[model samples]
Target chain A: MPLPMTSNQVLDREFLEIRAKILDLAASFDRLDRADGSVVGDPRQSLVQEALSVLSSTQKDRAEQIQLLFSHHYEDDWQEKFNLPSAAKLRTRST
Target chain B: MYYFDPHIHMVSRTTDDYEMLAKMGCVGLSEPAFWAGFDRGSAESFRDYFRQLTEVEPKRAAQYGIQHYTWLCINAKEAENVSLSREVIAIIPDFLDCHNVLGIGEIGLNKNTKNEAIIFTEHLELAVRYNQQILIHTPHLEDKYQGTRMILDMLCDDSRIDRGRVLVDHVEEHTVRHVLDEGFWAGMTLYPTTKCTPQRACDIIEMYGSERLMANSAGDWGPSKPTAIPDLILEMRRRGHPESLIRKIVYENPLEFFRQSQGFTFKSPDADDASTINDRTASEPK
Candidate 1:
């Protein structure tokens, strides 16, 4: 049980601020990782998301950065988008 | 009048099954590659199973003029050994091209253990990779409840799976609502001793109304007869079930489910046979 006011306000405030930054980074990276991030319909991404969710925030942020860096080389989240319907143009070339 | 049995383990059954089912009006049957009532240790055992469902058994079925198709994979209870299960899974695609190999399953939780869950997810991945439908086996006896919960939980985890493309098999009264509520296909098995009988399966149909549902005989090394499904069809007719109602459970429902896997269409027999879903004699073998 967390005491009503036992934790330091400064530390709590700092945690919230860091968490916000982390989420923002995650959201943007999510977009870059998927050109169709609007639909996040790729189940493997859901697989990856579920896998990454188990990690701590620091690890998650690092993983997001890796995803962002790799995905920057392409126009879309090609890794997850390859077999899906939206990436039909890119899909034909790979085959 | 034709009937489709969604589940029959014909490997352990005999020539009598064919002669018996043919006379009873069983035009089409779907055999799920269930465990042969025991764990198969080697990749070779599963390979032979693949051959039987894909090659040997269908030939035997065709000779009887019964159209046979199969769901190919290791059974859930055996899938508890994740390593052996994966070995069985890897060999599946090789046999999938064989005649009547339709889907990668009878996959789900047997005892709902962690090992079973991992193997269940692997089966889901195979289904997505091949763009195939899945047939799930919800466990029996003591493990039934936990197995159903575990199967649904893993299924919900993967968005690649269309819940409608999965048939949760071996459903009894307690398990039907959970199977139906998830938007997946609900399957009832009619076995004389361990599982629900045909009479009970018909009772379930009466109570639930037969949409998104089907029934079968999971007859195997266990003392069950594959003709039980045809009996259920007859029981439905005896009680004044509409011809349309019997057709939905015995023919249309299973036909649609198997059709999701490419090239598994039912080419109805041109001959006069008792297997017609609406045939009054469909349940009695001459």
Candidate 2:
């Protein structure tokens, strides 16, 4: 696994600024996926899915990512709020 | 004796299909949302249709001891009507929570239209977002050869999707090799006309053997019968097909299919149908 961004890596301020910009781009890509539906299918969604997967591994760095990568979906946790049907509905039923 | 139909259309079929199918040892069926004969005017049409599929019908099937599952999506062939399909596909995720829906699917290219391809890609996106398996529909008749090829090509070209996560349904001699060779699951339809017959399908089983292969009855408004799968199995048994091969083609194949899918878990088998014997009447299920 890649090492997490330390206080110095992010505290450099210049790199944090760049990470913030990338996170903004990620947020924009996520919005495009929401509005266009096709965006989530774009090859870029693979990158985002990967980045999101990686963000789960580290702690303090993960917190920084929570602020960086997910401006809307993370901040809102809207997937839960949206009230999708219960997972059981999709379950295979008794014959 | 556990039979599974990975592709079926419940809109045109009746409750008796569940009863008869259950009695015939058909324990479960996956109903793909599709063009049910004519076109609809609004998103509300699809809403009501989804309601009937996920709510009204499954309860009816459960009453008869058959498990009814659904693949939710806008039909691909009608995706020529892209504007409406987009509207319908847009709302499909809202209905995903209904206990019977398996995924946003039975979606793919038809007429090989750019607009249809766009919709197909979007549906793929939805599956990825929701983490669900895809049930793709390859066009029929004249469109079969080229359309199936086109759908698989798009899936391959799209790096975000995996071949194993999709079911490229409605295979014939022309497309079965490519579908299986590509490592995607292949589904065969047993329509009396337009699709393969039981004898021919069994012959395909003999030739292709089995890997990621399943057979279904896309019984719809046409003269097609819902008993197509049963006929294929019956013919296979009559022609000296080993019981294991029949189980592999029908029961094991589909069961393993849903089992591999994301967020999908097995529903209990209808444990209460002790009264219904496996001896089914010869009449067709309407």
Candidate 3:
């Protein structure tokens, strides 16, 4: 039988995947930056802006996925066990 | 390495540009009617423009041993003036039979406005009625995504329109996949400022294998380069892409798409098998 993965292993894998995706996104941005620097105006600006918008949305979605994964893996008494602030407390503190 | 610039506005260009394009291996090009940097006053202005495209430009290109083809339509910017657009559309048939005239185009949304859509549909109707090919211009900058979506929706709704015969020009990275996925040809305009640069165009080619895709300079009166395709050639070479792949995108693809037009009887310089060369002068209209 296959051994069950520990929470750390699952989290590590997810982090690796997310990190790789971020690196890929950064590479795309770098390539766009390295493109012909002679072009200056709405056309070049719009192309870069649109690409960034797509990458930003993708990054946000990945972040949400990571948050969901963390929430799913958390113990029922995680807040108390970890001594983390409650949502209500965090909201108050943020305000 | 011969290349075909499937979409460019040569009316705004001087004869010197023609000589330069010929020197750079641009054997043929298509000039789609567009805004003359400003809205023309009347339909008569369009008539004169069409005459210049059909009569003057071809003769000038011929001097440099280049073939010239053209598309006719009141550009979307001027299509806002519906009454004038209709008048212009009415006179388009007079020039349809001209030897070098290809079809009706450079027609699509400008601002993604209602009037533009109305005029766009009318141009579609004319194209449908006459069985002409279409070349489209999606809007610029902030309006590009919405305008492209609107144009795609309009095109999709019309079942009579052959998606293959239509080419959506000025496509950027965001909009290009949607165009190609929907079974339509896409054109990447390589401009010095405002459209896809040579490197960016090469990147697009890498992302989307060039099937129905081609590139053009859109060499108009604005700040644009007429030799942009050659720059793309250089970029493709620098990236180590094979000559065949580059030729397919720059030369063969446009030829394949344009071959659908009855008026595009292009004879490549290499088709110089003796009998065919001799027959050319004999077939010239007396």
Please write out the lDDT profile of model 1 over residues B213-269, one tens digit for every residue: 998887788768778877887888887889998988988898888888884856767
lDDT of 3 by residue, B69-165 (tens): 9999999999889999999999999999999877989999887666787788889889988999999998875567667777887787678789999
**DockQ for each of the predicted structures, in order?**
0.01, 0.01, 0.02
Q: Write the per-residue lDDT of candidate 1 for residues A6-58, one digit (tens) a residue.
A: 46875664653444344344543433443333535878656656766733233
Positional deviation of B105 in candidate 3, in angstroms?
A: 0.6
- Is candidate 2 or 3 superior in TM-score? 3
lDDT of 2: 0.70
TM-score of 2: 0.69
In model 3 chain B, which range of ten residues has the least summed lDDT?
B274-283
Residue B281, candidate 3: how far off, in angstroms? 14
lDDT of each: 0.71, 0.70, 0.80
Per residue, candidate 2 scores C-alpha lDDT tens digits across B1-286 of 6788788777788767777877777777888888877888888899999998887766666666566788888887778787898899888988888777777778986665666766787787688778888998887555666667667766765565767878888886556887999889999888754556676566567667888899998777666777778898898898787899998999888877887654355554655545332223223243
Q: Candidate 1 at residue A95, lDDT?
A: 73
True contacts kept of 2: 0.00
- Report the Cα lDDT for residue B67, model 2: 68
